[model samples]
Target: MAERPRVWVSQPLFADIVGRLGEHFEVSATETVVQHAPDAVAAALREADGALVTLNDAIGAAQVAGAGRLRAIANVGVGYNNLDLPALSAAGILATNTPDVLTETTADFGFALMMATARRITEAERWLREGHWRQWSFESLLGGDIHGATLGILGMGRIGRGIARRASGFGMRVLYHNRSRLPEAVEREHAAQYVGFEALFERADHLVLVLPYAPEHHHLVDAVALARLRPHATLTNIARGGLIDEDALADALGAGRLAAAGLDVFEGEPAINPRLLALRNVVLTPHIASGSLATRRAMVALAVDNLIAALGYGPDAGRPPSPLNADALTHARKRGA
Candidate 1:
């Protein structure tokens, strides 16, 4: 009999999606839903051949160093900051993320959040719910407009392109800044202008953050960057939290240095900076940008597929939709390293 591969699921994801993994591997999962501490996660990884994790689980290099049998880690979200890439590479392990399936869905959420922030949707709803809507006034809920405004996107990847495509219908001028310039044809098709980061912060009436999180990208939108924006601008972040500084953002909002903000991710998961929460100008969500019923299910399905493939079962097992550390395979084979 073939010995079933030992797999650990770090979180309680979609039940059906998790159950499917059981068919191909010996799966161990937590019964109750909770964020596992790094020590707990490390302990679990020590006994498993591979893991299915969420962004909340921080799998650092030290943790992976102890996992002698660890081969692959299938992340439930598009972001992979939770997993230490250098550590994973050093350990010769594969890391996969569910990317393409969530692109359009996440972009839709980014647009919606931006609009909600710009138009004061959440604040207005709260005003009504608190029975403060006794009478109507001309400037009662005055907010910024989306049409004819400039939309600034920090990242020029798949999701950023999706956001750019949506700008046309709103009659927005899209400006983007990426590490490398996208093709001239793509820019012409989307009517997006590739600009410098400084120009993006200055001219954009609406700024959206979609850049990947890295140590170098930590606090990319610091207080200085926030100060550079127009006072009437709206800031939206659907990307990883570390891309912006929450305290700096709150300070800007408090001082009226910035108009409003929509945040789907934060520097820390489950715990948001209290300063941002105290302000009415900021709209906050619990990192569910790719959380549409259909999209989230698809994300889980792809993750399940990755786990199955990496476990040497499915036809495409070991071939993930997106592998963060694809170079690890080559390094592992070199000198049998």
Candidate 2:
């Protein structure tokens, strides 16, 4: 009998779903759930045919070079920044990310964060907890209204489109900006207006950043961009960190250049800018936008499918659901390497 493909799961995940992989492939999972440093992941890949990793695992070219048997990496998040694609492709390795599974869940949190920021929920709670809510006054915790407001979305991708769809129910005028505008038919269907970046900044009553993080997109929301926003505008970012300049954003919120902000991911995660922490107008949450138990489980499950499939084992072997570098498949087939 042919040997079973070997998979090393970087972190402990849904046991039952992981067990499914074991039925068709030999699976080795970390006993404890923690981020594996790049070196550790590379070491495991030296012997593994494939691996299932989360955003915490950093799999790069050097690691891939050492991984002679490694053919695929299954990332459990919608974001593949954790995986170095150029490096992986150079090594003739396939990489896949779980995208669709977390869209709705992350969108739900994005909308909720926007509401909390606009309503001053976190700050007011802290004030109440600090014994500052002595009397009720109409002017005391004043915040902007959301109803009948203009909602501008950057990046008209799946999650951005989801946010725009929700805006319709809120009676908001949906405006979207992307690399190239969405089709006129899509705009008509979603009741959205296609606008330029300048117009989105100038007009949105509430702005949500839902763009992907890329080299060119680093610090996309900088001091100058913040200046274009009205003082009453609210900002919500459910995208990657580095998309916004943490210091510049804190300054805007601190000086009242912008009304309030909701942040889930930061430029340097787990360690946020101390300035943002001191501000009263920001709603901060650990990076858990797609962290609902079910959604997270589904993400892991999908990633497992990717790993097993790419390894040419299991029910859907060789049939990865979402291959990030699709060209790799043709290369894998042509060279037969």
TM-scores of all predicted structures: 0.96, 0.96
lDDT (Cα, tens digit) per residue for candidate 1, span 1-337: 9888899998788898789888878899987787787788889999798899988788988787688888889999988888888878877788889989999999999999999999999999999998988876877989999999999999989999999899999999999999999999999998999999999999999999999988999999999999999999999999888889888899999999999999999888678999988999999999989989999999989988887887667788667667889876765666265
Off by over 4 Å in 2: 333-337
Per-residue CA lDDT of model 2 for 1-337, tens digit only, reads 9988788888888898888788777888898977667687778999988888888788888777788778889999998888888878767789999999899888888888998989999989998999987786878899888889999999989999888888888899999999988888989878999888989999999999999999999999999999999999999999998899889998898898999999999988778899988888899999989989999989988988888788887677778988998776665666464
TM-score of predicted model 1?
0.96
lDDT of each: 0.89, 0.88
Model 1, residue 34: distance off in Å is: 1.7
